[model samples]
Target: MKKYNNLAEGPDGFVYTARLPLSSATLNWLSCLIRGHLKKIGSWWRALSAGRIAGIVLAVLRCDQRPSDLAGGNGVHRTTVSRWVREVVGLLAARAPRLDRALKKIARSGGGVVLLDGSLIRTPRRTGTETRKNYSGKHKCHGLLVIALTDDKGRLVWVSAVRPGRTSEITACRHYKLTAHLRAAGLGAIADLGFVGLDDGGPDADPAVIKCSAVPAQRKARRDYENRVSTLGAPA
Candidate 1:
């Protein structure tokens, strides 16, 4: 990777550049990390090189572009792009254990706090039993539920398996046994009001390990206190 040096001042008083290169050190480290898993197998011609395949995956994930749109822009068939995406996903899945260990090391070394939250990923509408399972009353859309745990710096540490959209955030956490995992890792977690009961000092709850802010009430002072707590608990 090369350093970016083409920055220019625009009319709007903002500096702009065409390309930003990754640090050579970082690129080399990443290359060495994935080199073993990205080995070539059968002697067959490939339309896109390994670099291009990685670029396609990053664009789709970071830019949130559709496969068809990316295919058109890259002058490749949609099926080819889709296949590359699946291949990259499988490669990452296979390396999940290594990734988890790395994150655990960081958490333990730094004694960093973890932030737990649930998000809904939109999906196409479905019929029959699927409709009931994937419909989110809160978002008024069909989606999948995913619980993510991030470090205090907002870097993702772990993500739970997808659940139906209708599942509450707290329910999903329980289903995934996230509390035990957090306890085992010896890391504290901060969650939003949606996980109210999680830190309520119940027989199964560990208030010290998992803390959550109280939901805002009708009174103005109560709402202000809740807001302050939320602000304090939010990850940097």
Candidate 2:
């Protein structure tokens, strides 16, 4: 991959931002497109100033700021920010480019590679949500199964969240199709062992091929590495 030792400057004499794989102009264009969509969705823009909502969403995405945390950022109430976040998540999930295209752009390749993995978000204990043990068997938590597809650089292209602890990785993945951008870029999906199930007479199952795990040595390090590799092998 070609590496840029320093950030590039734009035609408008503004310094380019670091960490974003896309160029400044491209990012601006994409943000504008997103804002345009938000405007059309029942005047979320009218409910709150466009700048405030945009700022709140960007803050949440960048700093993990919750709606309650925005009480001091601007005069906007926490409830307003929370509503914006929900609307933003829903819009982005439906309108964002497919994972494959975003990956190909970042990698600067004709093809794209995506790492599909799940994350857990803790849910309120009082609610009737499912709870599960930590993989390490340390504690219990309730949360959704989130599968994210990211490029080699770990930039997220797509994310899908499901009910707290309702299903395993393979089942959750079945709800999402390969992103359109990824499909256009001839992208490939990679996942862990929990996903290695046989096809269920579906067309989406054909591209994936599972490789079985080998017996592991008694040593903990070797056993862990083997387990990781086995999980990374494609699902059947």
lDDT of each: 0.65, 0.54
Q: Which candidate is the best by lDDT?
A: 1
For each candidate in turn, the TM-score is 0.69, 0.53
What are the per-residue Cα lDDT tens digits for candidate 1 across 1-236? 99878657554343222222444464344344345445555424567655556666666765666788767667789998898778767767766553246446655566445778889999998977779999999999999999887776787777767899999998887776666665555555767667766653357653423444545554665565445434443222
Instruction: Write model 2 residue lDDT over 94-128, tens digit each, in one string.
Output: 77665444655644653334666777665555423
**How many clashes (backbone atoms < 3 Å, residues ≥3 apart in a chain or on different chains) does model 2 have?**
5
Model 1: lowest-lDDT 10 consecutive positions: 11-20
Question: In candidate 2, residue 101 scores what lDDT?
Answer: 48
Candidate number with greatest TM-score:
1
